[model samples]
Target: MLRGRARREQAAHAGGTPPADDPLDAAQERRVRAVLALGGVPQADLPDGVQQVRLRLLERAAKGEEAPRDVSAWSAVVASRLALDWHRAKRRQERLGERLAALRQPEHQPSGEDNRLLSLAVARGLDGLPDNQRQVLVLRFYADLPVRSIAEELGVPEGTVKSRLHTAVRALRARLHEDEVV
Candidate 1:
């Protein structure tokens, strides 16, 4: 699909008419492909994402904003930002699920107030950890992956993965104990 899009872009640049049915022009297609190649978005989403970029531009134009003077640059930025937003939203959803699960624990269930506090504390602890430790913890606990799997996924040694998880868990425990609210 990427190859086809690239071909179409090149063809457009070479004076061939773009696909009449395609929503995105050659430049927009190029920008969308560039954003996808940056690695967050899956290749399968190219067609829909390209169309969505065009639709987004159309929507902005409908708001009476002038067309961007540099369409390619603008499209690339918008597409990249949108992919980042999607990635963050997915992480937030996963974190919310983890917190909800923690809140549902038998010990925390007796008081809605306590559950809420514990959930918030966990979120804060997760956010406070260093990126390496937090990522290892998330892969270990949230993703339910074993140490070996996490090490493979993260391209690190299993010992490193375990070390990070242990440290992250310890830090979270300390934070919870400090709060005395959860």
Candidate 2:
């Protein structure tokens, strides 16, 4: 599967048009990819962004409209706009996820008083940790992300994530014990 993907990417960058129906030519596709990349779209998503630009161009052609006077420039502008839209959608999705998570209830409900006290202690302990350590802990535990995924998302090494998790957990545990809250 990966090999096939690699081949497709190579074909894309090689300036080869795959289908007769594709509205954007090879050079146009390359320009679209460059625009999207410089616009902050990740490399993995470039192909999809280029295809989106092509789709819009094709739709315009289907509508019996004259092709844009300069298709290359037009595609680049479209790709840039797509990149901005992508970031907006990503932010919106993240905000919605947070709101949904806040509304979610845990399957097992402990005694309310005990649960409240423990939650307070944990929140306090989390607040006392350094920002990096706290981020690692939350991503690992609350987000339920594996260490490797956290490292990739944060652009840090796995070892760094592991070390931060260990230090944060130890500090929080010590604080809870000291306060007799856990």
Q: Best candidate, lDDT-wise? A: 2
List, residue by residue over 1-182, the lDDT tens digit for candidate 1. Answer: 98998888767745734565444577668768778658487777766667678887788788998888877878888788778866776786788798767746764246767667778999999999999999999877776667998899889999999889889999999999898953
lDDT, each prediction: 0.78, 0.87
Show where candidate 2 strays beyond 4 Å. 1-15, 105-182
TM-score of each predicted structure versus truth: 0.44, 0.49
Candidate 1: worst-modelled 10 consecutive residues by lDDT: 14-23
Report residue 172 deviation for candidate 1 (angstroms).
0.6
Name the lDDT value of residue 93 in candidate 1.
73
Please write out the lDDT profile of model 2 over residues 38-116, one tens digit for every residue: 9899999998998899789988988999899999999999999999988886776687688657645557655789778
Would you list the clashing residue pairs of candidate 1?
none
